[model samples]
Target: MGFEQLAALKDQLAKQAEEKRMAKRAQHAKPAQNAKPAKQAEAPKQAKPGRAAPTAARHAQAQKAPAQKSKPVDPVVLSIGKLQKRFPKAFPKNPAPKVPLKVGIFKDLLEHSEELGLNEAALRDAIKVWCWGSRYWACVAENAMRVDLNGQDAGQVLPAEAARARGLQAKRQKTKNAAAQGGAAQQAGADQQGSAVQQDAVVSQDGSAAQQDGTAQEERAVQQDVAAQQNSTAEQDVVAQHDDGASQQDTPAQQGNVA
Candidate 1:
C-alpha cells in the first residue's frame, strides 16, 4: 500500500510489457540454420536485409497490443475500472481529461476499500497507476482544482505539487529523448556497417579471389563489434530510464503526484 508495494506493482507491469515485446520480436525472427556456406559466405553475404523484419514486427505488435491488453484486466486494474464507474466525476472515463485528485485521496479511498471489495494493496496500486500516467500529470498544474470522491471541489493544486509534476514530466521526456537518440545511433551504426559490408563484398567479387576468406573473417569481426556496441548502448539507456522512473515513484514525490 506504500511506495514499496506500489513500486513493485509498477515494475511488474513494466516487466510484463518488456517480456511481451521481446517475445514478439523473438517470434518474428528467423535464424538461418544453414550456416557455413564457405563458398559464398564471403564478405558476410553483405548482411541480409534482416533489420526490416524486426521493424515490421514491432509495427505489428504496436497495432495489436491495445486489443490484447484490454482482455487481461488484473485485480488492480479491475478495481480501478469499478472506481471509474462508481465515481465518474472523480474518475472520468477515457476521452475525458483526467482531473487532479484531492490531496491525501488515498486515505479517502481506504474508507471505501472494504465495501468495494478491494484490498489495501490493490487499491494502492490502482490509484498509483491512475496517478502515474502522463495524462494525470498534465492535469496537476498550478491552480488546478482537486476533485473529491463526490466530484466536488476539495482544494486547489499547490505550487509545490505542480512543480513536482513538471519535474517528473521533464525527467520522463529526457529519458525518452535519450532512448530515442540511442536508437538513432544504433540505426546509423547498422546502416554504416551494412554499407561497408556491401562495398567489401563488391570488392571481393571484383576478382579479389585470394582475399575472400580473409574478407569474410574481417566482416564477421566487424559485425560482432557493431552488435556489442548496440547491446551496450541499449542496456545503458534502459538502466537510465529505470532509475529515472524509480526516483519519480519515491514516497514524497509520488504522494504529491498521487494526491
Candidate 2:
C-alpha cells in the first residue's frame, strides 16, 4: 500500500468516530430538553380547575362537617336568675338555699317527667313556670319535683305513703281526744246521780225521826191529863160524901128542934 493511501484511510476513520460521539451527545441533550418541557406541562395541568385534587376537597369538607355537627342548647336547663329576668311572672325570684340549683337536679326532674310519660317540651315548660323555686322546689317537688342533697340531685323527694301515714296518725290522736272528752262527761253524770240519791236518803231519815218524836210527845201529854182527871174525881167524890154526912146531921138536929 502507498503512504498517502494509509494517511487518508486513518483520517476517514477518525472523522467517523467523532461523528458517532457527537450524534450520541446530541441524543442525550435532546432528551434533557424534552424532560424540562414535560415538567412545565405537568405544572400547568396541576393549576387547571378541572384537575383539582379530590382528596383535598374531601378533607376540607370533613373539617367543615365537624364544625357544623356541634349540638344546640337545651331549653330545660334554664337558670333561675335568667328565668326571673326573662319571665318574672313565672319565676319571681332566684332559687332559695334549700331549693335545688344544681343542673343534675334539673336533669333528674326531666327524667322523672319522662318516667311519668311526659314529653320534653312539657318538662321544659314546667321548669320555667312550675319549677321556679323561691324557698324550695316544693311546689314542683311535692308535685313532680326535685331536690338537692349531699351535692347530688334527687327527683320524687317526698314519699306519698309517709304523708298519708302522718295524716292518719293525726286523725287517730283527734279521735282519742274526743273519746276522752266523752268519758269525762259520762263520769260527771254518774257523780251527779250519786249526789242526788244521797240527798234523798238524808231527807227521808229526817222526816221519819221527826214523826216518831211527835208521836211520843202526844202519848206523854195524854197520860198526864188522864191521871189528873182521875185525882180530881176522887177528891170531889170524898168531899161530896163528907158534905152529905154533915148536911144530914144538921138537918136531923134542925128537924128535932122544929118538932
Candidate 3:
C-alpha cells in the first residue's frame, strides 16, 4: 500500500509540472491586437502670387536725419585772445611778449631754461644755440633794440615779419650763390673758348709764315731762271758779231785777189 501511495504522489507532481509549462506556452504564444495607423495630415498652402509682400516703414526715418556741421575759428584772432588772457599785464590789448620770437629759438629756451625771463641776451643766446651756434646774435639783438625803442612787445609785430625776412634772406643767399656758380662756370667756358681761338690764330700765323717762305723761295727760283736766260742770249749775240766780222774780212781779201 505504501508503494502504491508513493507512485500516486509522484504522478500527481508530474501532472502539476506539465500544467504550469502549458500555461507559460499559452502566455507567450498569444498574438497582440493590430493598432490603427494614425491619419496623415495635409501641409498648409503658401501665399498666392497676386498678394503684395509686407514691408516696414523704417526707411522713411533716414531722410529726416540731421547732418553734422563744424564751426569755423580764425587762428590769428584766437591767438590774440589767448595772449591777452595769458599775459594781461604785458599784452593788455592783445600784445605778445616783447622778445625776438624765432620759433626754434623760443622752443629751445622754453625747453632748457624757462626762468631766463625772455630777456634780449637770453633770446639771442637761444637763437645762437638754435642756429647751431651761429653768430647771428646781431639780428636778434637788433630786433630787441627795435622793440625797446618802440616800447612794445617785439614778438607781436616782428615775429611773423622776422620769420618771413629770414626766409627771404635765405632764398636770396641761395640765388646769389647759384648765380655766382653760374658766372664762374661761364667764365671758365669763356676762357676755354679764348684759348681755343688763340690756338687757332697761332696756327694760322704759322701757316701764313710757312706759305710766305714758300712764295719767297719760288720768287728766288724765278729770278735765277731769268738770269740764266739773259746770259745765254748775250753769249749768242757776241758769237754772231764775231762771225760777221770774219765774213767781212774774207770778202775784202777775195776782192784784192781778183783785182
Candidate 4:
C-alpha cells in the first residue's frame, strides 16, 4: 500500500475516537443536573413548612422536662429542728438536760423526741440510766409531772357531759329547783291559811262566851223583880188581919153598955 494512503487512514481513526469521548462527557453532565434537582426535592420534604428541626425540637423538650427532686431529710433531723424551734433557750445546741426534771417538761420533749428515734418509755429509761440523772439529760418518774403517766393532760380528761347532755341536765336541774320553790310556797300558803282559820275560831269562841254572860244577867234581873212582888203582898195581908181583931173587941164593949 502507498505511504499517503496509510497516513489518511490513521487521521480518520483519531477523529472518530475524539468524537466518542465528547459524547460520553455530555451524557454524564445531563445525569449530574438531574441529580441536583432530586436533591432539592428531598431537602423540601425534610423541612416541611409547619414542622420544627429534629435537633431543635429535641433540645426544647429536654429543656421543658422537670428536674429531679432532692432526697428527703431524716426524721431525727426533722424532730431536732422542731425541738430547736419550739424551745430555743432549752436547746441552745441540743436538748440534753442532766438533772431529774419534771415529767411535764419531758412530756413536752417527748412529743418531738419520738421522731428522734426514741419512744416515750425508751426516752425516759435513757434519760434515767444513760444520763444517770445528769442535768444534761432531764429525767423524771412517770408520776413526777403535772401530766399523767399516760401522757394525758393534768386537767379534765373527759367532760361531765356532751353539749346536748349538759343542756338536758341543766334543764332538769332548773325544773327541780322550780318544783322545790313551788312546794315551799304551797307550804307557806297552807301555814297562813291555818293561822287565819285559828284566828276565826278564837273570835267565834269569844262571841259565844259574851252571849252566854248576857243571858245570865237578864235571868237574874227577872228573879229579883218576882221576889219584891211577893214581899209586898205578904205585908198587905198582915195589916188586914190586925184591923179585924180591933173590930171584934169594940162590938163586945157596946153590947155590955146596952144591957
Alpha carbon lDDT of residue 38, candidate 3? Answer: 71
TM-score of 1: 0.61
Output the TM-score of candidate 3: 0.22
Query: What are the candidates' C-alpha RMSDs?
Result: 38.5, 50.8, 43.2, 49.1
Estimate every model's Cα lDDT from 0 to 1: 0.78, 0.48, 0.45, 0.47
lDDT of 1 by residue, 46-129 (tens): 435655466778998899877544465577778889899888999998899999998888889889987888888888888888
Candidate scoring better on TM-score of 3 and 4: 3
At residue 151, candidate 1 shows an lDDT of 89
For all candidates, the clash counts are 0, 2, 1, 11
Full ranking by TM-score: 1, 3, 4, 2
On residues 117-204, what C-alpha lDDT tens digit does candidate 3 reach at each position? 3444444433333222112221433244322212344343245444543543454455455555545545554555555455555555
Superposition error at 145 for model 1 (Å): 0.9
Model with the higher lDDT, candidate 1 or 2:
1
The candidate, 1 or 4, that scores higher on lDDT is 1
* Candidate 4 per-residue C-alpha lDDT over 1-259 given as tens digits, one digit per residue, 9 for 90 to 100: 8999999999999999999999999999997888744444444456777889999999999999888899997555555455445544433343544222322455555766645666765544433332221232122222322233233345321232123223333444454555555455455545555554555555556687755654554455445445544544444444444445434543332222111
Q: Give per-model TM-scores.
A: 0.61, 0.20, 0.22, 0.21
